[model samples]
Each structure stands twice: as structure tokens, then as C-alpha cells.
Target: MSDAPKAANPTGADPEANQPGLGDLRVIVANHLKRRLPGRSTMREDVAAGMSIAVGNVPDGMANGFLVGVNPIHGLYATIMGPIVGGALSSTQLMVITTTAAASLTASQPLADMPVEARTGALFVMVVLAGLFQLLFAVLGLARLTRFVSYSVTTGFLTGIAVLLILSQLPTIAGYPVLGANRVMQTLDLMVHIQEVNPAALGLAVMTIALARWLPRTPLRGFGRLVAIIIPSLIVALFHIDGVQLVRDLGEIGRSMPTPDMPSMLRLAPGVLTGALSIAAVVT
Candidate 1:
């Protein structure tokens, strides 16, 4: 065989050389899987998990914002922004430190009367502080301190939170007032007004919760929660239970999207710094 260097393409280009797209990325991933995993299979569970997280946040963010004495839109903004910022700076790959209903409620108690800009400034500060703390922790090699909280303690804490979540949503699910600006007041108020509850609304709420719990296991379960809410809500609407006490409607949905604004630094100062630090502590 003659030793000859391979000829460069005379056209000096390959048609598919720089055509980078999702399919190309997928092909690369498939090749990686073929080499690394060999026989094991995965259905992109991470994609599904991320989607679930995104969808789950919509209702939760709105509800939490309402509970926290802030516009629901802000809660939604926090949900979107928190994840991106947290993901970028956090060393932990699996951390999902978005605003929780309880955390937001706690933090907002102090910041309630503050101006929206001030509150936002506070949130920014808190995120920055939290990021700094995380970095410090990493540098200090104190990440292992998390292990001091025993597994059982962690489990119990999470379990208690789950229980609280189920109990706290009782009013929303039962079509009654959530009561109180804080946890104690809300709980007490619910207890006091337990007698004046609406049956149809309550029934609809229960059905929605049940469907949300069970429907995901079945094939057609994807739309189960929607079906549960819509069907019962429609029935309630058609019946008109009291005529005096009516189901609240948001009314006239809009299709237009809002414009985005650039963020400012000077807007966030001392109060924001304090508030953010407080919030970051509570979060940790």
C-alpha cells in the first residue's frame, strides 16, 4: 500500500459538519449511552422530573404568594428566578431550594407592609447571602455538618411538613377561608369557622385532591386533576347552590404576555440586605 496523506475535501466543507441541533445532541447522548451504559435503559427520567417540578410550581407559587401577603406574580417570579440563580451558584447538583409556602409566609410577615420594590430588594439580598453562605460552607469543608441531622430526624421533619401540607390545604380544598395572617391565626380561624363551610365546594375540593393523589398511577391519569376540578366546578356552576354565596371566578382570561424589565442594584440596600439575610437563615 502506498503511504499517502488523505485528501482534504476539495469543496472544503462537509454538509453536516456544523449542523448542531437537538437531534445531534440526542445522537451524541445515544452514542454515550451505547458506550457507557451498554444494556441498561432509561426513559429520560430527569426530563420528566424537571417538567413535573415546573408544572407543580405554577399552582403552588400562586397559592404561596397569596398566603404570604404578596402578589401571586411575585411568587411565580421567585419560583422561576430562584431555581436559575440557585442552580448556577450552588455546588449541590440536586438542590431545589425554591420558596416554600411556610418559608414565604414566615419571611413575608415582616416584609408585608414594605414596598414591593423593597421586598424584591430584600429577596435579592437573601439570595446573594445564601449563595455566599453556600460558598463559605464549600470552602470551609463544612458540608458534612448536614449529616449531624440524623436520617430519622430529617425523615420526620419532612413527614411533618407533608402532614402540614395536607392539613393546611384543607380550607382551599373545602372551599372555606384559610384564616389568619400567620400559622396560629390561620389554624384557629379555620377551627372557629368550621361550621359555616360549603358542602358542594368542599366536595369538589375533596374530589380534586383525591384525583390528584390517585390519577397519576393509571394510564389516563395525566388529565385526572383537570377533569376532577373542571367537572365538579362546572356542576357547581350550573347548580348555583345558594345564589347569594357564589363560587369566586377570576373572570375573562387574557392571552397577552407582559414585557420584561431589567433588574436594578441600588434599589436593594440595607433593608433588603437584612431581610434577605433573615430569609436565607430561615431557608437553611
Candidate 2:
């Protein structure tokens, strides 16, 4: 045949021009099935995992923010983001992901000295630095080093966190913001001022914790945490109980979507730099 320029693809795409035939297509799909999608035969597993995480964690996510002396909304964001980002990375075990509460607790340590107004911005920069450290660690293949950390040490560390968490929460549960040098002292002050505890708040807190404990044993176990969170809220709304402080009191919730913004390096650096390294190490 006489040589002539081949017709351009209708979409002006090279991919369409050299389209593979059925045999080649089968080979490509087979390879993909065998390699990239070996365990994930369908989207159902991912959907179920997402639902489980959201339902189980959202309430605690709000509380986790208080773990670090910030707005519960910030903890709420971290709780939501942890799974979405960590899962996208194909992390080995979703159940073991403690980045939401534990990491926030760790991050709080460095920001404790910063002014309340400056803390949010400084926290954002520290998050960026922490993410960078995670990437650096992965690239350096330092993840394997964590396997050597002793089990007793790990248990002790987590036990300490749990105790601290309980101590930190006593003030909120009792509706008395006690002041002291540490959580232990705050807890002691709370005990001393036990009579100042708001009856309605204390009752609601007890009810919520009871439900959280009791719900897990029932047939509706999957939604236990969600139910535990909602029941107390409904009771407060229905009764118009004034003693208990609602989450809305902490800050106004935005109705609009968030806009992306660059962190102010100059303004935040001084406040965050000292804590950045520590946060980065913990996060990594």
C-alpha cells in the first residue's frame, strides 16, 4: 500500500492510537489482578473499613483534642484524617493506628508553652514537619528499628498515657476546670473540690461512660461508641440542662468547607521549632 500519514486519534491521544487488542488487554488486566489487587478483589472491604473507623472513632476524636489542650474539633479532624491518610498509604494494620489520640498527646507537649492564640498556627507547622520526618524515616528504612523496642517499655508508656488521659479528663467530667502544675495535681485539686462538681454534668458523664461500657456487649456493638456519644447529647437537649457544657461552647463550627493555606513559617517557626524535632521523632 502507498505510504500515507495515519489518521490522528479522534481524541488526539497517543493511547487511543495504539490501542491494544483483546489478548493484550487480557494480559494487562491479569497482571494488575495478580499484582496490585491481589488481596483486594472488590471495594467492599475498603467501604466496610471506612465505615468502621468513622463510626468507632468520631466521638473519641472530639475528646482526643482535649487530650492535647486544644479545641475538641482539632482532635476530631485528626481522628478523621488519620484513617483516610494512613489507609491510603496501605499501612499494615489499621487497628493499630494510634496517631489520632497518642500522637496528639505527644504533639501537645511541645506546644504547651506557646500562647493560646499562637498555638494553632504553630501546631499546623509542627504537623508539616512531622509528616516530613515520617517520609524521611520511610525513605531511610528506619521503620524496622521500631520492632526492637521492648514490649514492657511499650506497655509502660501506653499505661502512662492512659493514666494521664484519665487525669486530664477529670476536670471536664466534673465540670470544674482545676489548675495545677501537672495532671496529677489537677486531679488532686479536682478531688479536693469534689463538692463543686456539677451534678448534671457528672451524671451525664457517668451515663455516657456507662453506655460506652455496656453497649459493646449488646447486638448493636458496632455502633456502641456513636450511641454512647449521642444519648447524653439528646438528654441534655431534651432537658435543657445548663450545668453540662456542650462542644459548641468551645468554638463555633464552620458551615463552609476548609480552604487550603500555606503555613506562616516565619511567625510559627520560633514557637514550633523547639517542639518540631520531638514531634517529628514521635510521629516517625
Candidate 3:
């Protein structure tokens, strides 16, 4: 009763005492939920940041979608849904989830065998299965598996992907038909048809690459990639650069949001499963 402060519930006898039990677990979970919830003061800033990221990522997403043999608008859809869902559920605040070149490239292999009409459905099934696999891995606490992936192996894999990207774009850059059956054959075809390369398209490609490389070093670094894409595009439009291709040349871009559709279960074949696993590995 004196200055001892009643021993501060030392015996843990008080019903209201904080104890390690279901109530404590609830408090822990609530605290985690609170941290994830956006605060009123930062909500506006969060919206602005999300919008900026969405805008900035569109070009890359389109490029990835093109590589995957899908309509480029599908890339934008992937970009939009990925960031929104990923940002909401991820524990890390700064992670940006979006379509990647590696995933697109990997997905193309298994899908290469599918007919033109069936490819889209197959791709959808592959993505859904990949997502389910990822959820399973998370539940199994298998994230540590990535730690075993050697740095050299990763570097080699990325370098190969970069070479593939460059090879795949060669036809577009040179204004040639995408004539090859595989990347190796494509390179051979491009080499044999080197004399037929379109000067205007090649020039644009060179200029875009140069700008993409140099602009990032200047004070306007933040807008480097965007400027690289936009300036060349504007010049192509204004000058009517013949033989240069645009995404619209390929197919009609969907103007509205994509509606969710159920993927065909029959399309989830062994080949698609393999491709989905490959995509998930690269994405992870």
C-alpha cells in the first residue's frame, strides 16, 4: 500500500493482466493489420505514388506483353492488377509487383506450341496456376529456397534473357518479318537478311537506345526512360518514318478494363504447368 505500487501484478493473478494467450495473439494480429492499413494523413500521397508508378510502368508492361505473344493491353492489365493486389497484401511497403521480361520470355516457350486462338486461354490458365503455386509455397514457408540459388546461376540466367530480348527485337528494329522458329534461327535469319534492314527503323532503334543510356546520367534522370520512348515515338509520327512499326500495327488495343474470365481447366496441361512454374520461379 506504500510506495511499492502493489507489486505491479507480479503474481499474474489479475484477470485484466496482460498474458500470453489468445487475446495477446489477437492484439498482435490487430497491430499487424493496423500497420498495413493506410493512414488518413498519408492516403493522398499513397494514391499519387501509385498513380505515378502505374503510369511509369505501362511501357515496360507493354513490351513484356509483346514478348509473350499476347496483346500489349494484356500487359497493362497485368501491371494494374499486380501492383494493386500485391501492394495490399505484401508486408514490405516499397515492393513494386509488375510484369517482367523474364516471365514473359519464359511463358512464351510452352505457349509457342498452342494455336493462335488457344494461346490466350492457355496463358490465362498458366498464370492462375502459377499464382496458386505461389500461395502454396508461401503457406509452406518455402521462401528460403531462393537463398540456395547461386549468384552466378542467376547472373547467367539474366544475361541469357537479355540476349534473347535483343534477338527478339531485332526483327522489329530492322523492319523485317518475324521469320524464325526459334531465337537461334531468328538470329541466323536476321544475319542473312541484314542487307534488307530498313534504315529508318534502324536509326530510330539506335537513337532510342542512345537516349535510354545517356539521359539517365543527366539531371532529368527521373524521366529518362519515358523521354526515350516518347521522343522517338513523336519523331516517328511527325516525320512519318516509313517501315517503322507501332503496337497498333499488331492488333487492336483494348480501351477498357479487362473482364475476368474463367480459364479452361483442360488447357492446364503438363506443358503449361512447366511454363507456369518457370514463370513463378523467375518472378519470385
Tens digit of per-residue lDDT, candidate 2, span 1-284: 97985432233343432433524443443344234543656688867766776788777777777667666777667766666776555423313354455677777877676666667677777888777877888899987686566668878988987887777778989999888977788898998998899988889999999999999789767688899989999999998999788888876666653455666677664646656666666555
In candidate 2, stretches whose alpha carbon ends up further than 4 angstroms from where it belongs are 1-46, 91-98, 269-271
Give every collision pair in model 3: none
Please give, for residues 191-278, the per-residue lDDT of candidate 1 as tens digits. Answer: 7888877776677667767876776666644445445546666676688664222322322223443345434766654555565555
Clashing pairs in 1: 126-276
Preferred candidate (lDDT higher): 1 or 3? 3
Of 1 and 2, the candidate ranking higher by TM-score: 2
Q: What are the runs in model 1 whose C-alpha is more than 4 Å off?
A: 1-53, 79-129, 139-141, 163-168, 171-182, 221-284
Candidates ranked, most accurate by TM-score first:
3, 2, 1
lDDT of 3 by residue, 38-84 (tens): 78999999777766576668678888888888777788888888878
